[model samples]
Target: VTVCCVAADPPAEAWVKGGPVDPNLLGATTRSFLAKVLTSLMDRFEQDDDKDTVAAAGEALAQLAMLLGGPGVHSVTQRLIDTCLQLLQQEHICQSSDDELDGEEDHDGALWEAVSELLM
Candidate 1:
């Protein structure tokens, strides 16, 4: 899954190289491919317990969300938000104090921050 995330970055960077995206640049086949890859990443994110795996999947989904748009795209955005919220909920269970989070907590927090940045 980490490999998938690593693999996603370059193309994502290329796709968003210009300031604003023109959706027509992504044709039907490209959109379909992205949808498949995004779905796979989301699934991996939900199933993985390893922090690195989860973080990678989260990052990849965030990048993909930056490209996916138009009429049916709200479903994708909603699903991504739901997934991030679910991750936050799970992280919340581990919180015991306001200022005593450890390394794992930091990782989860950072991942949440990244997701938040993407959503906004």
Candidate 2:
């Protein structure tokens, strides 16, 4: 997986949704096409709190799951749940200071909520 779905720089929007490169150009298949695509994209926001990207990731994941139908989707969905939960754990760890923790008061909740909403 490509670490960090996106770089913290200009035109960051490309990391999640629309950008210089269009994902539509690539066809989805059983192989690692979409997985690698989303994996790379999600890896970007993995450490970043940008809830917008997280929400977008959730949507993208759902679409991928649907495309990879049956238990594959369920399996992928479950893995996504695990991944989101892990990210929340990491976010908690990164909140070393009280102020930082307070700042992210609802950050974890919101992130998971978006993921859950997407799954549901």
Candidate 3:
């Protein structure tokens, strides 16, 4: 995951407006690899119980979306918004419950902070 994030950082600017690498820059093989990476990240984001892992996956997803710059950006943006809304709902439920939330709130708060940063 860390490796993927690092690898994506360098090519980010290239995919932006007026840059050399456009949507057509990637070959079939590279596109296939990116698809696999995106799938894996989405899976981790949805299934991971650890808040830190989920937050990292969310950041990676945002980075990958920017690097790809195509129809995928819209889909990924919507997905991230949906995920954040779900997380917010879960946090509300947790707060309303009687269970102890001292540590849980901290974890959720950090995750929310990270997701907020990515969205910005």
lDDT of each: 0.55, 0.47, 0.60
Per residue, candidate 2 scores C-alpha lDDT tens digits across 1-120 of 211221211221223232223333322333334455655555643544465466566666655544333322332445566666765565523233345455465765655665665555
- Candidate 1 lDDT over 11-36, as tens digits, reads 33344332445544444555556656
Per-candidate TM-scores read 0.56, 0.43, 0.57
Best by lDDT: 3
Q: Local error of candidate 1 at 74, Å?
A: 4.1
Task: Spell out the clash pairs found in candidate 2.
Answer: 4-43, 4-44, 5-43, 5-44, 6-44
Of 1 and 3, the candidate ahead on lDDT is 3
Single out the weakest 10-residue window by summed lDDT for candidate 1: 9-18
Task: Give candidate 2's error at residue 70 in angstroms.
Answer: 5.2
Q: Mark the regions of model 2 whose C-alpha exceeds 4 Å error after superposition.
A: 1-32, 70-79, 86-113
Name the lDDT of candidate 3.
Answer: 0.60
Candidate RMSDs in order: 6.9, 11.3, 5.1
Q: Model 3 — which ten-residue stretch has the worst lDDT?
A: 5-14
For model 3, the stretches where C-alpha displacement exceeds 4 angstroms are 1-13, 17-29, 66-75, 91-101
* Comparing 1 and 3 on TM-score, the stronger one: 3
Best by TM-score: 3
